[model samples]
Target: VVKWNIDKAVKGDPDYIVDRINVHYNIGHLQAVGGDSTRPAGDYLLALNKLSKDQYLPVGPDLPENQEIIDISGEQMKMLASFPTPPEPHDAT
Candidate 1:
């Protein structure tokens, strides 16, 4: 996840402030409800991770996708839960 200062960004002053946490594996996409049009975004975010790897039990070469539930309601983002998904989950709401 990433954190940005909107006030600085609007003035074109490099507002990217932090790198946040590095999830278990590679993340394909990050999404939230009403994210695009919402002013403060949403209180939660779903990290669509591509590979399970060490995140779950070994299931041969083909690893299940991981959907990481993140809590963005507070000052810092936190991983709340993880659910194994079928193979490739292109997108989520």
Candidate 2:
């Protein structure tokens, strides 16, 4: 996940990137809390990955998909935690 320092971007800074974090393989969806609404939901984000890969322990030949929870309530986005989802490879909904 890349968190751009928009404060710097607005000021025409060439390097506006402030933070970057690794997520699971092949991200399918990136949903922000209350992002569909008009209200502010700037607290959390969900990285719906299409593949878990080495992010979690494998049960069989297939690795389960995952939802990586990211904390966006601070100056820098932090990967708080993650959990393995069902066998569905791309269940963003």
RMSD of 1: 2.8
User: In candidate 2, what are the lDDT values of residues 3-93, reduced to their tens digit?
Assistant: 8878999999989987788886678878888877799577888888875666677888788778888998888788888888766644343
What is the per-residue lDDT of model 1 for residues 1-93, given as tens digits with 9 covering 90 to 100?
776677877888874564386678788988885676747467888888885666677687677789988887777889899899867887775
**Clash list (residue pairs), candidate 2:** none
Best by TM-score: 1
lDDT scores in order: 0.77, 0.79
**Regions more than 4 Å wrong, model 2:** 53-63, 87-93
Q: List the pairs of residues colliding in candidate 1.
A: none
Model 1 misplaced regions, further than 4 Å:
12-19, 36-41, 57-62
By summed lDDT, the worst window of 10 consecutive residues in model 1 runs over 14-23
Q: Which candidate is the best by lDDT?
A: 2
Task: Please give the distance, in angstroms, between residue 73's alpha carbon in candidate 2 and its true position after superposition.
Answer: 1.0
